[model samples]
Target: MQWIPDWGQARIESMVANRPDWCISRQRTWGVPMSLFVHKETQELHPRTLELMEEVAKRVEVDGIQAWWDLDSRDILGADADSYEKVPDTLDVWFDSGSTHSSVVDVRPEFAGHAADMYLEGSDQHRGWFMSSPDDLYRDEGQSALPPGTDPRLYRLMARAARCPSLSATPFLRRT
Candidate 1:
């Protein structure tokens, strides 16, 4: 493929060696907001954070993504909630796209909790979605971060706006 470079394996190896912890926070309104409460002074997640996160996730599963938006901090954190501030930021685009392995593929009983046969996205995803998805998959499922499918397809983007005449440009352009 014209897109595949001769030194691709070397680049991949370097990325593996130098990659940093994925920061999944994004300052946007289009995704599932990270359901976290931070201490106003300590600047840390609430001590009971995991319990609160589970509650928020349950609400999301039952009432849709907006459940977090509708919830008052006190509703989940109780009276002491006033001491903490709910993070208004949404999840990073990478985390949002990377989760499809679970949300789309594994959720169906027919899929046997495995990855899909193919994943097609823009070239920009090599670092964003491609990287984020597996990181999230392994974290959540304890399986190798790599999905069973091949590396996602990538195309040359036009400089004007990074448009991929073949796919929606938002996933590529937004991240760039």
Candidate 2:
């Protein structure tokens, strides 16, 4: 963040420090389910959540979201299905989209690499999608995604290119 404005840095820092517990599940008819399996007695994730996640993903890849909506846990888990519970809750909007960088971008060869040469978002997302990025990347790779000296150029994506545009081509705000 050496190049980031001081106030921008501070604002994001504040939001990160006060962030709330994440909710990765939702109740909805149209969305991807969280694909989490829980121990029937403890309400904890099954020991093979990752495997189950992949199984669900493979089915989704072939049949689309309906694969999850129409799944029969017993067919996948076999006898263990009686001991674990498949959560029907869909992923929260934020958790689903916020994970795209890791899930989609990182795994797909064509999209693999730095998320972007420049990452720009409104101040409002500091605590939501933008803030979730660092931890999400680190959680998977054991290090922050933004390598040192490779900090993304922070800028706001403005809605316009210029103002008083009836006469001039000059932008209303140009970088100094």
Candidate 3:
């Protein structure tokens, strides 16, 4: 929510225009399920949905999202199965992009202990990857590599010394 840009808000008249729809349906079968059930007749979420979602999330945590795909409506909705339909949609592209840092840095070790030194891209990156990467970084950790309240001078010196093997010895002579 904090990611919304003031400039974009000023340009758009309605809230709907500013945010993308959460629709997850897709023609392909290679991602997380939308995790929603709709009324077969009304094509909307079934009543007592929040309870159902919590149950589904528990299963997802234990067995992964694929479990949702394998689940039967009767198991998830019980008596409502006759009236409701499962939505076959999955996650949005941005969700995957945004979660990379969490999945990579926090949950996975491929990017752990590594700091993103620079992000180079076209201007659109400000609204796309660049924006999402920082958000993901902060979500995993309260602050970034150079978080506030840390000494900038010391940080830079340490970073420089870390990269230079010869810095193991004192670089400058100290006059006693």
Number of clashes found in candidate 3: 3
Whose TM-score is higher: candidate 1's or candidate 2's? 2
Candidate lDDT scores, in order, read: 0.66, 0.67, 0.56
Give candidate 3 regions above 4 Å deviation: 1-25, 99-124, 127-176
Find the 10 residues in a row with the least total lDDT in model 1: 167-176
Sort every candidate by lDDT, greatest first: 2, 1, 3
Question: In model 1, what are the clashing residue pairs, if there are any?
Answer: 98-133
Tens-digit lDDT track of model 1 for 1-176: 22344354455456767998877788887787888899988989899988999999999999999999999988888887878999999988777776765775445566554444334444555677766654655665586644554343334444644453565532221110
How would you encode candidate 2's per-residue C-alpha lDDT over 1-176 as one tens digit per residue?
Answer: 54255577778777878878876677888787888889899999988889989999999999998998789989788999999988888876666556665665546676555554354555566766676666665755587664465646455444463232453211111111
Q: Please list the residue runs of candidate 1 whose C-alpha ends up more than 4 Å from where it truly belongs after superposition.
A: 1-7, 18-21, 140-176
Quote each prediction's TM-score.
Answer: 0.68, 0.77, 0.50
Better of 1 and 3 by lDDT: 1
Clash totals in order: 1, 0, 3
Off by over 4 Å in 2: 2-5, 111-113, 140-142, 161-176
Number of the top TM-score candidate: 2
- Candidate 2 clash total? 0
lDDT of 3 by residue, 1-176 (tens): 21133343333234334656544346468787767888877787777778888899899999997889899999977888888888877776655664554454555455555544333233333444444554555644576642343221111134455567655221121111
